[model samples]
Target chain A: MTGHPHDHGHAHAPAAAEDGPPSEYARLGRAVREILVEKGILSAADVRRAIEAMDARGPHLGARMVARAWHDLAYKARLLADGTAAAAELGIEMGPTILKVVENTAAVHNLIVCTLCSCYPRMVLGIPPDWYKSRPYRSRAVHEPRSVLAEFGTVIPDDVEVRVHDSTADLRYLVLPRRPAGTEGWSEAALASLVTRDSMIGVSLARSAHEPVETA
Target chain B: MSDTPLRRHHDMGGLPAGRVERADHVLAAWEKEVDALLVLLSRQGIIRVDELRRGIEALPPDAYDRLGYYERWIHSITAALVEKGVLTQAEVADRVATIAAREEAER
Candidate 1:
């Protein structure tokens, strides 16, 4: 077997678990991780490299794709037709799940939520937002998506149909948010700046061309 | 009236709930490690992501509600490792106690 896939320097120091300083889950996690390491099930570098790779994936990747869709109609069709291949075309590995890109149109607004235990397109978005994983969001996103969207300052008019996609472990969704008006002729890079993580998740709309970019 | 469809606590969807609080924070280092370990172990074919999900899903509602996202993952990951015979529960327990003692002595 490989070096205890878990053995090597723990990336962090020990603490308490459950209630005190550290969490019980935390201690158990560490203990379990160390034992595996000692067994050569996992190495320290394996753990570290895994984490580094995850950290490398960010919502920006999704933003870039959304921006590309806005820049090229053919790419948009491809994204909608086959998200996995399109992502591969862009050199983005989508991990194990199949990505489904839902486009937001003038009359149809799409929202993405994993009602079950926070399934998300983590391959590109890295970790999901805390709110996205909360019981409130998970429970309410499908039943009251408009309200949830309103909570995020995104109001959907009565005329527009709001569609919420419930993601599973094997299938994930990404929102191809409608490009803001007046962004015509904008370069793909510039357009990408307006595609906020929330926009890609359908919590918010893409920023207006005149608006300053979101820091996140 | 139609009978209410029963669902697991974690299977909540379209269920009446409170308002969503929109907030976010960076993942702590340990949480990231838990995530990484799960990924690495899955890559090594020692465990499957769905197995981790099952472990999380099987959590009693109280414990499920109590643990954070990564906390839940680590709990499930640890349990799965023990079940797979890849790591013994005794060793894990002893290591946890050892860690608890070290943390206590440091304080």
Candidate 2:
């Protein structure tokens, strides 16, 4: 509910016309935003703050939740039973949308997708990676999940079932990836470090304790 | 396409497509702005999230296919604003023209 100081500076304006005229969609978007700000329906500051809030969210939060669940069987049960409340217990507000935590286990692998659109668990994991929204991903994830996972270098054994969760409703899905072996005594912080965004999204596995950590 | 049971643009799950390439492109500046605008509009109750989704789904198939992730959001937000009578198409066009002219002058 805070207002941002209105700066007339065009610092954040779209790039110069050389990139070809801003697409019609972009032009109209800018126009609508300007009109809203001009009429006092919304302020530049309000928008900036909202953007900042979104920017602050990232996979670290989700990784922490995963690590905590990995260490505490009771907490893992709670997380699986009610993702929304469990996330709130860890100081993450999931907003109005319902978040469902799906676990990856020995016999099954889980993958998340929004067949209808780019519905994501942004509250915990921030904005989705670009590939998650691509037509290839949206289509392929559910159609041929194992192949899609392989593209991300995640190969599932033939004995394991691949479960694809299509986020077609209000429920957003986050994968509670199987905790990698060889880290039985690792601290929660160390364990969380092994959780990458792609792993939470179920496209890749969490890094092992001995493996180097990768960032998105 | 005709054989597929799910023809809706948003119902893209379980269809055949290309390989999943892993490339990380920094979000464009304008895209960040648009994302903020959409979040603000929804937060203020000026538009509902469901309405925004419908707006995106309402885009023509070709346009929907052509637009990038944030570009689709831009189109949806603009359409929602116009549809809600928060802004008229003419006013938007006029404002866009003015902004375009201003950018021209700056260059």
Candidate 3:
């Protein structure tokens, strides 16, 4: 599956810089907009409205999928077996343009990285977070997933295993980490509480009621 | 130009950012890609070199550090363009409408 080929090239460097207190990118964008108007490529009103829309969409439906699976065993099983279908079952539809989701399980601890560029499953997981598309995470994750995980403060047991899923083509992955112990009667919402974005990407495990960790 | 996107061919390692060594490797690659883009866009007249240079200079010392990754750049650009009217609201609405239509049609 492919995503909307939004500009993923070098043409965006100056504008792609990080936002500070005042957000320099915003200022640069204004400059770029002025140039575009002078060149007759776009109108000011049009650009302002479009940015508003992008923000409204927020993260993709995949975050909900992860939350659901954390609470239900059968759904988690189905998600693991057929991610695209399972997601639809929850009203999360995938388009021809949308990338398919792959669930990484315990036998194979699935990790996601976009090595070449940031091709991701945005429809489900929202936008691929910044770190997922970086060159370092992509390059080293494939070469040394364990070492990479350790950097994130995630230490996989020797027996748990690791499997890195490159986010390319139509196949983007979400890790269905093994549910932690000590929360037998936890509600789905409660379980969802433990499913951090990092764990969903498979670098860490979902927190159990007993061993809670910081999730941002 | 008309091939499977090159991003699919390269291998991405892990998530939540990797170790400094891995992080450095990835950031360097993205920075290189960004530089290449600056040059190419300038050649295409999509951007001016002086303007780009000024913009680059104006960047916060921790601009990249605050965001700390390349994909953030991609996200912000996409967001900023959409905001600045470089991308059209109607275009996004129409694409979304088209996707919704196709789904209804499929069912």
lDDT of 1: 0.84
- Which candidate number maximizes lDDT? 1
Q: What's the true lDDT of residue B45 in model 1?
A: 90
User: Which portions of model 2 miss their true places by more than 4 Å?
Assistant: A1-23, A214-216, B1-6
DockQ of each: 0.60, 0.61, 0.12
Q: For residues A189-213, what per-residue lDDT tens digits would candidate 1 score against the true structure?
A: 9999998889989999988989987
Candidate 2 local lDDT, B1-107, one digit each (tens): 47756578666777678898776565544666688887788778988888888888888889889888888887788888888898888998898898777767756
**Winning candidate number (TM-score):** 1
List each model's interface RMSD.
Answer: 3.4, 2.7, 13.9
TM-score of each: 0.91, 0.90, 0.54
What's the best-to-worst order under TM-score?
A: 1, 2, 3
Prediction-by-prediction clash tally: 16, 2, 19
* Candidate 3 per-residue C-alpha lDDT over A1-216 given as tens digits, one digit per residue, 9 for 90 to 100: 111112322122222223322233332333334444445665434443333333333233555677677677788778878887887897765544434445555556777776655555554655455566555676787778888788888887788667776665657666665667776776766666676667777776676677664543
Q: State the fnat of model 3.
A: 0.23
Number of the top DockQ candidate:
2
**How many angstroms is residue A18 displaced in model 3 relative to the true structure, after the best TM-score fit?**
8.7
Model 2, range A71-157, lDDT digits (tens) per residue?
A: 999999999999999999999999878989999999989999887888999999998888888889999898888889888988999
